[model samples]
Target chain A: MLEHVVNGLVLGGTYALVAMGLTIQYGIARIMNLSFGDTIIAACFATYVLFSVFAINPILALLIVGPTGYVFNLLIYRFIMKPLVARAPDEGALEVDSILVTFGLLFVIQGVLLVMFGGGYTSYSFLNSPVSMLGTVVAGNRLVALVLSLTFGAVLVGVLYRTRWGMILRAVATAPQSAPLFGIDTNRAARTAFAVGGALAATGGGVVSMFQTFTATAGVVFTMKALIVVILGGKGSVPGAIVAGLLLGLVETFVAAYIDPGLTLAAVYTVFLVLLLVRPNGLFGKA
Target chain B: MTMKTSHAFLLAAAVLALLAAAPLLIPDYWTGVLLGMTGYVTLATAWAMFSGPTRYVSLATVAFFGVGAYTVAVLNETLPYPLVLLCAGGIGMVMALIVGFSTLRLAGVYFVIFTFGLAELVRQTVSWWEVNITYTMGRYVFLPFEGRHIYWQLLALAAATFLISWGIGRSRIGLALKALGDDETVAAHAGVDVTRIKLLLFVISSTIITLVGAIQAPRWTYIEPSIVFNPTVSFMTLIMALLGGAMRLWGPLVGAIPLFLLFEWLSVSFPDHFSIILGLLFILIVFVMPEGVLAKIETLRKGSPK
Candidate 1:
């Protein structure tokens, strides 16, 4: 049980990092990037390829992955999102169109990755030996992921809270039209927030590369999880994402450990159903 | 009926008659593919019938399709195919009504998630059900009909679905659905029975979709939970409908045939990476022709500076 919880925390922390990126985009853009996972998965595959071929340091993989994610989202915003925004005159239409566009985006990314990576699973192992942690045996790479994720979470939260750019982002998220009136370039801020979302995707990809073997389809599953986390945590709240992320991590791990591991997604769906019925606004989402 | 409605009816009947007879004229290989293509057309048309009018991006077609497939797998041996198909469709209706009522009251996004969750939920339940009870993980079905017989059966189903869709597109409920899709609040204020219409459409669409799956299951010979509940199947139907023109009566067939041909060609050309080509195509469709190809052509005909 202790081991499961410890492992779950690390998993949750990584998911939280991913969810925070989604949260920022949703906060500002009010659109969920379902293809967000594509970037993360790309980062994973790119890191694995780089390590295998270039003989690069595994620990420094994020340096490559992070910028790739950033550029990927920038492309998305430029090519896909901007056209969608131009076409949609209303929020309802925007919501539906964006969802469909992202859904298509999801498949496109999955297909491209499948072409690049095939169906084979690739993984990176940092320290294969198990480390004893508070009487629970855990893998060292998992521990590294946990530590890195927690640090990333702190730095992310800090950046959002303490930075001028973060404040500008918040203002634009709250009031896109009025932000420009207040001398804030809402479009630039929104684009920057998307880049931040991409960085989170890269961090998530690195975490997965460090701890688990992944295929092209692996990131699709994360999109579902991260979307659920964002919704359950509240759309725009980083703190809410962390709380919900940890909660979901515990929920998934404990359920998978105690029950059949295959039913983890079913359990998450059940949680989503309950959340929709009980609290659509989410735990920390503003009205 | 108006001239336009009558014209649509005649066109549908002609297409149905031709399809109903063409199995003999075409080669078995092409016949088999066309039969399967009709199955997708049925799924896509019915899906668009429900979703396009409501503007609800439903992900529950997988749930209904899987349920229909599995229901037939477990019960088809004891029951006649027709009765089994009915039961399967009835089950789909029940599931749709349950899910639709519970989730449709919320926002549109919630509906999307609920449908998505329902698909995953149904898939898991089917897997668990097979593991615990079925003992036979892969159910080998003894379908009484041969390929051509099955082809005709699927054709009838496809035609029936198209006819129903045509009728609904002209009906008062269809108008209400289209209105609701544009703006729910306004539709409600305009005295549209938004919930009831949406629910009814949900049931109608699920029934046709489920029947298609149940009917198509026999063609594959072996039924498994994983194959039956695959989300890709649903995505293809959804994408086809969107690619052709979700609101147009000809959308499903127009989209299904060409895309199926394209998919076959791609599979043969680059079997391993067809998914990539498909994904790129889907993205291209969304970007270049959001209203679908038919819409694009119509615009070209009317709006182009010739």
Candidate 2:
């Protein structure tokens, strides 16, 4: 049980990272950003290519890929998101159009990746070391992922709470109409959020590559998990995403260990469904 | 009736006639492809009928399709084909009702996510149980069928789908669904019984999709969790429905034939790049013609004012 708990926490940390990225985009930009998964996959592939061709250490590759993800996301926002947001005259219509456009991006990215890389699983060994935790042997890669995730989360929380840019972002998220009056460039804020969100997602993907074999199509499953985390945590709620991510990780780990591995997704989704039914606003979300 | 409306009907009739006679003109492989396209049409139409007009996006269509496919596959081992097909559809309707009741309360993107999560849950459960139970059962049970039979089965299913869509298009429920799509809160306040109407449409649409799957499983001569429960199917169907003009009764059938043909062509020409092309097409359709090719044509026609 303790082992499961530890495992769950570690996994939850990874989920929290992904969820944080999703929360930023969903909260500030108000776009579903379905292509979030594509960024993750791209980061994974970038890491893979770096390792395969140059024999670069996975840790260094992650550092490089993470920033690439940020730039890619900025491009997506400028090319795809900015146009959609500008065109949509109302909130409801905006939501629909955003879903369609982001979903379109998801498809295009996944398809291009599949063509370029073929549907084959690839993985990288990062740690080559193992650590004992709670009377169980745990991977050093997972430990690295957990530490990085927590650090990233703390930095994000700090940035959101302490920084002027973060305050501007919050202002935009809360009241878009007032932001312009304050001379805040709302478009720049959105672009920054998208880039940061992408970086975080790529970092998560980099961590994932160290632990699991991945293919071009793996993004779909990752996207589903991120979606579940976001829903469970409450859309646009950062702290809520963190809490939900950890809880989901725990649930998935325990389910996989004791019940059945295949049912892990079912278990997570069941909890999400129940949560949506009972508290649509999420556990920590403001009504 | 207006001459314009009559012309549309005439065009539809001609298309139906062509579909009915397609097997005679096409090669055997092409005939099979057309049959597969018909199945996609049925699934796409059913999805559009419920979600498109009601403005409720469901990622669970593939789950319903899988349920129908599995039901038919399991039942056919012991029962007649027609009976299996009916039961498959019934199973799909029951599942849809349960899912709809549970998730329809959430609004907008919440509904989309919940439905998607539910579909994932179904998929995981199916994957877990499929191998063990099906393998054990395979020892004692089996079904016999040929490819050509699938053509007729799919054709009949397509006709039934068209009739259902036509019926819904002309029904009070259809009008209410449209209203709900336009504005859910207003429709609810106007005594639409929004939940009940949505649930009813969900059941009907899911059932039709399952019926299509029931026929399709035997036609393919195999069924698997991943293939039947693929989210790509749901996504592609959404694209097709949108591309043909959502809320248009015959849009899916019109959209799917050409889309499937394009898919086939792409797969043949560049197998690895097929998904890339399809994805690009999806993006193009949304960006360039959000209302769809047919809707664009209709708008132009209206602007011309004959």
Two-chain DockQ for each candidate model: 0.51, 0.65
Report residue A46 deviation for candidate 2 (angstroms): 1.7
Q: Comparing to the true complex, what docking class would candidate 1 get?
A: medium
lDDT of 2 by residue, B161-270 (tens): 77778788788987887788888889999889998888888888888877776777765456666666777777778888888877687677677878888887887898
Clashes in model 2: which pairs?
A: none
The global C-alpha lDDT for each of the candidates, from Candidate 1 onward, is 0.82, 0.79
Global Cα RMSD, each model: 2.3, 2.6
lDDT of 2 by residue, A1-287 (tens): 88788879889988889888988888788788777887888888888888888999778887898898888888888888788888887777777777777777777788888877887887877785989876888889888878888888899888988999889888887787889899999888878987888999998888778777898877766777888788777776778788889999999999999988878887877787688778877887767
lDDT of 1 by residue, B1-306 (tens): 256866866886897788788878988998888877888888889999988778888877888888888888888889887898889989998888878877777777778766755666777767876686665687867887777887888888887887788788778977887788778999999998888888888889998888888887887788888788877777788789989988788776789889988877887999877666676777788778878789899999999788
Cα error, residue A37 of model 2, in Å, equals 1.9
Name the weakest run of 10 consecutive residues (lDDT summed) in model 2 chain B. Answer: B133-142
Q: After superposition, how far is residue B177 of candidate 1 from its true place, in Å?
A: 1.5
Off by over 4 Å in 2: A134-136, B1-18, B21-26, B117-120, B132-144, B302-306
**Against the true structure, whose lDDT is highest?**
1
